[model samples]
Target: MAEQTLKEKTAKGLFWGSINGGIQQILNVVFGIFLARLLSPGDYGLIGMLGIFMGVATVLQDSGFSTALINRKGIKHEDYNSVFWFSFSVGLICYVILFFCAPLIADFFGHPELTNLSRVLFLWFLIGSTSIAHSAMMTKKLMVKERTKIEVSAMIASGIVGVVLAYKGYAYWGIAIQTVTNAFVGAVLRWYYVKWRPTFTFALRPLKEMCSFGVKILFTSIFAQINANIFAVLLGRFYKEDQVGYYTQGNKWMNMGYTFIWGMIGNVSLPVLSEVALDVKRQRQVFRKMLRFVSFISFPAMFGLALVAPELIVIGVSDKWLPCVPVMQLLCIWGAVTPINNLYIHVLLSQGKSNIYLYNTIALGVVQLLVVVSMLSLGIYYMVLAFVVVNVLWIFIWHYFVNKYVEISILDVAKDILSFCLISLIVLCITYFVTKLIFNIYMLFIAKVLLATFLYTFVMYLSGSVTFKESFTFLLKRK
Candidate 1:
């Protein structure tokens, strides 16, 4: 296959990619409401505790081959078949290992219930392995439009199914069903849109090539997963089960913000940047565009969320999550900077410059744990402060690495950052004043969101940033 232009991939990928993800987010928000009503915070906490290993294992499943397959020019069918077989095998092995190791894992956390939960969730790997390659094929072919359609449908189906089961008193089965069905349905649907299929034929040579790069990627991914999940682990150990659940749910909401914001960047930027894998100059331009794109949206979203954290928790998750309000407030910092930080991280990885990014992430992960430990050592209020500070460190550390390699220019990033800050400041101030009239939590929050959105769009228009009218209409009109 001939290499496509970066603009073509970026235009197609980011636009439809964001739509696919945006559709998923809308469904999740609705589903979250239902699930919160169905299950208590302790249930979610139980799962979160068990999920630390599963999360790390999920990251390891990628084996970096997805990046390799996407970035390497002229990848062949044979190479993919080999990669697919490798993933299929590793996934099976992972499930088996985790199945037996479940009790030990739960023991490590000193939670007996987690044993069964971990074992039950490990079954997802078996399901995941059965459909490993088709999704990769879809991405390789740049089928973003079709991909999004299936993804949206799958998310809707998964959410509805999970909510119904939870309503029927399935307990963690609700969570379990949603997790597995999402993989089961999405993978099956991907095969329908994708053009390639892997066969039984596999070769050691191709596996070796893929694994060589994947080893680095795999360990880096593990480090990242462990780092991200550490807080959940710590929460379970140092705090009450209810506290863990609240924090877990809080992070889930924060992930809603983080995922939607970063999902736009990741789905768009990674593949787009991969096409220009050899050209640092063009890569830098693309990176800046994404950074600014994120700032234009993420800054305001995070600011507004923080402004209404209390109400959001109270109403969004119901009173079961009141304990999470503080954690939600703290993690909002991570949410706001998520786009830029993630773009730079993806930029580094797409270029195979994982070591530096890995270093920063690992160092920060350690720092994060230390901060959490220190804060927990002192008290809960200080722990929240530690959480926020760790995220701040994450932002600067990523920016520093991005500056070192991408060379997109610090001033360029600062300009985007400064503008977003100013925009958020003005809009937040307006929201505060308007709340005097619309004092109800829901109404004031809505007022703030709508007003701030209009103001941000207006400022973006004045700055000649990507405007709605110019948003690649091909995505919407392709029917």
Candidate 2:
């Protein structure tokens, strides 16, 4: 009966999560098109230059306590209060430090405009920090529906604000304002939807208790951010802002593709895995099921994005953004498998093995930095290609650690995803040849999307893909 309940809860979470991701992506595409058309790559590049700083600051402000709270079996009001105050304080401090460091950042990038641009952009951390506890509460309760409402509302409000400003010639400032507005709106909505309110009372013990687990997560997140933004940092220093802009645009689209899958997997994976954490057998079962679901969705989505990069970018954002195409395609390769890596990490976290997660991520960040630095002279395309190759291959390393706790071997991991991966590749290859005769880019785009969707669906249905069948059934029932 408990297993049945979990199954239902998982389904409901996936449904809402998918809606959240889908709506958010659509809004992103809509707003992204307008802003991309209005703004230049250098405009995005200016903001992209601040990516690492903002990412690290945001990570520091949250301090991994949200995940810690979710992972805890029991929680008290004081715990949430303590986290709220702690996060609020940390956000203030990080912002202040970055505010003063802005000029140095600008100097490093040889863009004096970044001094002011970064100071304004840095405000998102402050606005976002206040909602950490509230957001964590929603995640813990699996309130994806509420979270979805909050996210979509925030995106729409911010998108309108961003588009208007961009249309008014605000340049990168439009993007920056949009970002800060999203945080502000989401924070406000989180407070509104989450009933829990923090009291003035705060305690050190709870913070200390969670910190032992959270501190590892903290460092792990830090390294993870560094790895993600290393390219931006390197490109900013060694190349032009427009070059960094191109990579940023590419990485952004790649992120949107994978984030759609990761958002759904993330909303349920940890909380559900934690529920079954004490039962090795049950945890393994849940983990594999989620793995299959992620594989079924991720492979085709990312591979298809890569296949249609040229048409999508040209039609959606115009040829001025064309330089980002190769970069996007290369990054899509890594994006295809990133959610699987995330699922493996969640398994480790659910089992209270954050130290392993930390070490592995630290190693990954180090290796990625070295790899990117080595390939710097070869230009952006090769650098991104090498980066993608390194990340995709790092799945084995993640598997090595996860196996120690979950006993999910590399072979088991490969078995779950390899078929989906191969099928997606073959289908896309066939679609490419099948649609080669079409000359109009718009028709070509439509044909590729339709033909690929039809082929992949027919294949999955014919092969009796349990994941596909279950997902389709669930949607039909929901409808």
Poorly placed runs, candidate 1 (over 4 Å): 1-5, 379-381, 463-479
Candidate 2: residue 265 lDDT (0-100): 69
How many backbone clashes does every candidate have? 0, 0
Candidate 2 error regions (>4 Å): none
Candidate 2: C-alpha lDDT: 0.93
Whole-model lDDT values for every prediction? 0.75, 0.93
> What's the C-alpha lDDT at position 412 in model 1?
81
Report the alpha-carbon TM-score of model 2 versus the true structure.
Answer: 0.99
Q: What tens digits encode model 2's per-residue C-alpha lDDT throughout 1-479?
A: 99999999999999999999998898888998899999999999999989999999999999899999999977989999999999999999999999999899989999999999999999999999999999999999999999999999999999999999999999999999999999999999999999899888889999999988999999999999999899899999999999999998888888888878888869899999999999998898899999999999999999999999999999999999999999999998898889999988999999999999999999998888888899999999999988888999999898888788878777887788999999999999999999999999999999999999999999999999999999999999999
RMSD of each: 2.7, 0.8
